[model samples]
Target: MYPTDFIERINSLKKELETKTPLRIEDEKRLKKKLRLEFNYNSNHLEGNTLTYGQTELLLLHDKSTGDVKLSDIEEMKAHDVALSQIEEMARENERPLTESFICELNKLILVRPFWKEATDFNGNTTRKKIEIGKYKSTPNSVRLRNGEIHEYASVEATPAMMTDLIDWYRENEPSMHPVQLAALFHYKFVCIHPFDDGNGRVSRLIMNYILLKNNYPPIIIKSADKENYLTSLQKADTGKQLAIIEYVEQQAIWSLELSLKAANGEDLEEKGDIDKEIELLKREKLSKTTNFKSKNTVYDLINHLHDDLWNSISLQLLKFKDFYEKANNEIILNHELDQKLSLTIRDNFNLFKILAPAIKIAIKDNHLDSTDNFYDIKNLLWIWSYSSNKTATKDIEETIEMNLQLEFKFYEISLVNNKYELERNGSLISTTIIYQSKNDYDTRITSESINNILKSISKQLIKQIKEEE
Candidate 1:
């Protein structure tokens, strides 16, 4: 259903790409590395694999899945990349025709093993279904859309027949159809059947690229950032506007071709600072493009990340004075609003970070916000943490945090700062840092060495004040 101009455009790009038949070794390696990582990352990420792009690259290169991530996600990413390699080999075997066996095998490889999955039966009941690696679905697998309507795939009894028909149709059309149209349509029909239980989405994408690679086109990446558009395009296709999805895939194909052309010219694939930008973009990829910054988001994330580490570092050294100040608490205020009024407390800091690296995500992805002004106070408290700067307070309100206590309370009152910190003892000053930027760069200092030094000075100052008063 492609327009004449669109088909001609792909053909023109395709013909010019053929002239650079044998790209330089370095260029080929760079392009392959980029494509392999991008495809595995975006494909799994779309299906909710929690590994960041940086984590994915580390896993692919050094076999290190950094950050707090699931063992299963690491294995899936590794296996999925291996499957990409396997498909590359499969695509090169021009003598062999595409088959259902290969597709099923690809699924088995990506999934790694059989597992139990939560599924919705046709009767609209939640059921725990056993998912076998490489097996077609035995139960009715359907999904509920955002609109609260059920979207059904082919019937369980008809799955085998439909899959066969799909494979037959693909093989028959492979020689005559434009590869982009062939791949896009195959992906559409296969996902419609929803042949397998869990990996259908990932497999459909893998096979889509397999079709393209067979025709010597670079693999197209449907980026995780554009997930809504990806799904919406398919939803429109479901409405009989088939060209909507084809056009979407065509645009991706053009990007792939342009990159390949750049590689053939021995040019850099990524722009300046693009790698850091990719990491940053992928960092927020889990936070759907639709997500707005909120308070539950701030306080929850505040407790999970380096905040606890900041506390642990400060408290451990301060522990020597446990006899005098056994338990101390910290709080945040906005215009005289108390901690009880705010959503944060010391107890909120737990191993909650193990759930998902500072953003337990599941912590609060809802409309429940503590502030009427769209949680602006919460946002400032989370990002630019400091007392003197009064970041947590609005201009209309007086926000007071203790940089240094009066020493009359027989203890030290500490404040988290945006950058620097100063400790005072009998009106003398010692400058150091308590909380600095974290590796993730998500928060303000709230440091170990500085905390220890400042705590020592303050404890001495408080003891001297107590003695003098006595």
Candidate 2:
């Protein structure tokens, strides 16, 4: 279905991406999550879901959401996450060709629980209809156009055979068709077939992305903001003008590629800093494109120091179990991808001393950390931590020790940031962070020695907990 020019463009971009096929696995993961959030937000928004981009990011990344939105919107947002996970898992684990069952499973996942809806029956009276989850629609489904015309999907009887034909067609043409063309055409055809009663559009988008992902192509986001254009392009396809939609898909693919390349090169994945104020108290910092800012030098330096300190504490904590690492010979690898949230205003306003947290992972060799009771094949343990700048608000410092055993224990709020140092029942357990200005007596008095002692105590407790759990 692709024209000569579209084919050439797709092929050239494909070849360019092929040269960079093996992106750093960490970058690949970060980019994948980034695209997933964008795709889910845009796709759901297209279907009249109200969650904003910021809300979507928070919900997906941190499982924390803030908005005046409906509960169905929240459920569907979460369901979309589960559905995306299902699609990726299928892509990774399923060896067989795409099947009717797989598509149905995707529908089921995106709508975790189904609810009944009122639709006009064949007799022209309203009836309560049970929208089946993970099954083909038994009732007639159609769409009414803006011009008061009706567009009907394949009959309920025809849905099964049409879906089978669609899958068969995909298998037959996938090898020869360019992926952009394959994905776009499949989306159009699937929408035309309208196999499901409720989630046809959503499932079609998912299937389209699945095709692109399976073919090693980056997923294209049909942005909801461009809804009019998307619908118009689909209409063009309905008129047997396939090149317009194919070209539209081609452009989105190109955008996806450009986005991936930018992210791979360590550019700011999102906009940072408030540019509203023309004149600042300090000059806007000129930053190198590589590290993004000169302040990153300071941040990285602090990160190195912090990493060493935390590593030392962990080492002392595990010193008695030297056999764990020595006899087992479990190597500890340091990955330097610090997840620093680059902010210009913070750097400009003050000497930004701390960075957003990154992590360190210690490989658990064989069954070294496994216990017979839990039978947990502990793969690798990790420590996630960061320091504070307190630029926006009083930063809450926390650290977590997580392993595949599903054991997570932490001393959350024992801080050097001018707070009470009382060691209570849980050794200064601060479940909820208290945010305010540091008291006069508590300010600027926290010393390295105090921090060292706290870490030492936390390490001992952590070690004790591990032993007890084992």
Candidate 3:
């Protein structure tokens, strides 16, 4: 018996898939219209460009008989157009780009009119023979396997029985797995089955996405750059090393989710602030001379402040901090009011960070002095305050405070010492003693300067040792 929730589930999955894939606006509108007509065939308005219940069955039969070919050449051009339009529309809506390979696959599915027998690779080579197996031969169209072994791809001659069984298994089992893990497994199984010799990869990917889309997860694009890694993970999956595949898929899913959000906001992933570039430039220009400079503390402090500001700004821009209260160890509460407040604070902080980072970096580079002591001191104070049990700050508040402190520290340490300033300039007199002196009869002194000086002196001596060795 057909599953009771099959139609509802399919619709839900379709909606999700549509969201991730890009579609021409016109195609999207047409698809909606067509789907409406298809789903509401009994309505009186189903006279023109609409399939009756009987006609729908006929269409299905035709599609199956033609080996699941997409209709594009029926006498009723409107109907044919609608069907092809819906397919293209669905593909585009899911933001699935139609590369040449994809187009070739689509052509293979053109049941109404068979066009090309095979798709050509980059070198224009076509696969013409069927794949040979132990006792059974399968389609020759197959992806490269990692162990330098190739098998007959399975999907091409997949029976309706097999498809039905697989679909049932997916419906029953997928809910138990994490969405990312499920997506990966589903993709692997679908591809391994090689259901459609000609368009198995594309269909398998589409089906994998269907499951994820149904679950409200984003689509993952295995980029050409990471194709090898992606294939390697698949190979691991085939060998029963499921964990590797799962991790790879999870990472890809997270990346895709982040990218989706960024794309929606019309932001480029590669965009970095001018301040970072300037800091890099300064490091390249000043490192050699500063490497030998004494009193390198000033440069270090300046660099730290700049680095902190840059990262602070970037985080502020990307994250939506929700107001959360610690209930106990790791437990927290989230409510609407807190969420709004935290979000606003996050946005404001991000803007502030962006505006201040470049200015701070520029100032440090120009001033060439240790003007960041106050900044570091304030940050340390905030860090102590936020993490203290006595403090009643929200999690968002604590995180923000901690982030600011770390940024300041990192900026100072990385930029000044490594990039622009050296410790040998000030007479190489690296050591000093902070002494508290009283009347000489029986005097006592408290000093930390000695410790600080010792560290500096040691650092300088090490650099000298390295220099001498060179």
Local distance difference test values of all predictions, in order: 0.64, 0.59, 0.38
lDDT (Cα, tens digit) per residue for candidate 2, span 148-231? 777788999999999999999999998898778999889988998999878888999998888888877788899887888888
Predictions ranked by TM-score, top down?
1, 2, 3
Top-lDDT candidate index: 1
List candidate 3 segments past 4 Å from native.
1-147, 155-160, 263-470
Runs with alpha carbons beyond 4 Å of true place in candidate 2: 121-127, 271-470
The Cα error of candidate 2 at residue 334, in Å, is 61
**Highest TM-score model number:** 1
**C-alpha lDDT of candidate 2 relative to the true structure:** 0.59
What CA RMSD would candidate 2 show? 20.7
Per-candidate TM vs. native?
0.60, 0.56, 0.32
Local lDDT at 194 for model 1: 97
